[model samples]
Target: MLSKRSVAASVLCALLATGATACNGDKGGPAAASAPASARPSASPVPTLAVDTLTADQISEQAHAAMAALASVKVDGELTMDGSKLAVHLTSDKQGNCSGTVASPEVGQFELRHSGSKTWLRADETTWKKAVAKEPGATAQDAAIAAELFKGRFITGGDTRAELAEAAMMCNLIKGLFADDSDKGKEKIAKGSAGTTNGVKTFGLTVTTGDGENLTLHVATEGKPYLIRMEQTQGSEPAAFDFSEFDKPFTVQEPAADQVVDFSVFEKKVKKA
Candidate 1:
């Protein structure tokens, strides 16, 4: 039999596994008081990167740096988790503006949008129930609201940068592969033969993570060497990601005031009930 702590650990892992979609940041219990937060844009000119005649590490490093300068980006891909597929789609701006949906095998399709630390979410009743059940001290009223009031509607919350980043990373073909503290030798970052995908001529750059996660990017060769496609090894099979809409505009419409419910309402109702 599993001990209580083991079970709790298992549950926590399961909840976190929904990263890039699952709620994070002070989300375990009765919703905390939410203060306004915004993902303001970084005030800097778009960095001009040298992408020509670069090595695999250069490609990755350049791509990570360029990603921040991107005013907006659209990313879509598959994420493999515990042998199941979590398909996701996202569009985000550098200022933390994000809008996307993740279709999880466990909880069905859930959509979330964010402006800075403020987030609005739309999901089915089951997803909401699963979300609140993970809360540290969620009450019966919380469950009721999750089922009736917040069901099938957009609900706002605080601390959304991490959540938005997770949503973006769900489709982020490049990030964390060469995290600051981890390192792999030159052998892992290699150049492969030229190829084409969907009529886009490209060369391949592959980086193997410290934990054995493999990332491969097919970059456009003719023009600016834009990242056209990405593939990552998940389990035995590789998950594919397609990148587009670089530096474009992305807007996540807020739910109408009448249609939205914030956590403060939940706190008041739960306490009174």
Candidate 2:
């Protein structure tokens, strides 16, 4: 039998897991039995989920379907690639619209926004200085001038620069993030026990990849059974990502004309230097 303290701790964990209120805080009692029927609180109807009875692979497929059905999603996580660490907080849609900040040790941090064929990039003085200094035959004077010219302004342009194109690809949540991993041809899928992610009750589906990496996907237990979080262990470094704001409406507004500079001008300046 669990002690009172243990029971209270479990209740607290459930209530605070998702950072949302999970219980009414009313202690169990018999007083409601004497109250009128109308005075009693209506019980919440239990949600019926088709994936509950399915195999682990089937549940993963359902979770992927739910994620694919969303119009947009917010992804926040850090990943390591080739020994370099990258952090990103992005909101992307299937229509190629995205707005987010990506940071890394090499390139510092930058804010990006994309809509249609236009893209806008903003960075601090140090980032601009480093970028300009990388150009062939660029001098310190040229780097300083580049930094001053682009400071406190956005570098806006079409999909002409390869670097910009790669950054903009982060907005493809459906193709890039919600991709079907079953085609990898070397993953073993298994069901995990019930758990909670950010306070939302979830059940996990763990996939052991060909490279011996373990990727655990957490699917919400309530409502639509949407994916709540994903955790991947690659060697010794672990990367975890949280998914939220599913199907929420968001607008990616272009920067004001006065606060923008064309990339062509910057490129020309650097080349002439």
Candidate 3:
């Protein structure tokens, strides 16, 4: 009976040791640790992009085509031209329809609603005062009166007047932005490192235009490789334009009858001032 008990105990000890060895082969199970080389999971492969291999100018041409195909987009930017810094926020289409605002130290701030041939502008008190004072022989009293009279009202007109024509042209803000002469000195274009803007991955192309302005154009890495943003960081007056809402449709409604004051009324008021 003693011999039988010893044999059974030995067998049990051997089984436990084998089980422990197999279970503790590594952090994972024995099969995983000792699996054939061909059976192991492979690392995920990185995706290849054709745009990444293209030349800087080729990439820019592609981006320009993408931008040109866009029917409408929301453009927001801080621009410096002729030593004046301006902030612009606009939702415009290729068809000359836009509703947005442009702000600057000289203009103060003004909102524009332009559709077809008509344009409506609503200027803040500072802008109203400035506009009134610009008229010939206008006094401070006139500026004050004009500012109060047109406060919170939009001045409407067709493209007949100079102010109206200029305001109406703002509907093509995107066109003016990416004009054909935008990058006249294309020979100086240099490819930049990959980065991201607003969570979208992009690669940049730095260029010095004919006007000597240094610009960095960031094009999206994925999808259609659209021009996502353009930044001017090299000059004394830094500026940036962020493009979004591609191909989105927007509408600009005419101001309410009571809220609108005709441009003739504004002109008469300024003349009296």
TM-score of each: 0.65, 0.76, 0.75
Candidate 1 local lDDT, residue 95: 60
- Write model 3 residue lDDT over 196-229, tens digit each, in one string: 7655667889876666667788787766666777
Model 2's TM-score against the true structure? 0.76
Query: Model 2 off-target regions past 4 Å?
Result: 1-52, 133-138, 179-186
Tens digits of lDDT, candidate 2, 1-273 = 433333322321221221111011111000001111121111246463454588887887778787877788777766655455556677888787989876666556778788977777787888766554444444676657667877888876567754455556666665556664544557688999886676666788888767667788888766666777777765645566677777778789889998898766765654454
By lDDT rank, best first, the candidates go: 2, 3, 1
lDDT of 1 by residue, 1-273 (tens): 443333322322333356543223111101011111211112233333344567777766655555545666666666554455666566766665678876666656677676655667677777756655666655455556656877666755455433334544433322332123345353367676577644556677876655565667776555444565677654553466566676656677877887777644554555455
Q: Is candidate 1 or 2 superior in TM-score?
A: 2
lDDT of 1 at 254: 74
Backbone collision count in every prediction?
A: 4, 4, 0
Question: Once model 3 is optimally superposed onto the true structure by TM-score, how far is the C-alpha of residue 16 displaced, in angstroms?
Answer: 90
Instruction: List clashing residue pairs in candidate 2.
Output: 17-198, 17-199, 18-198, 18-199
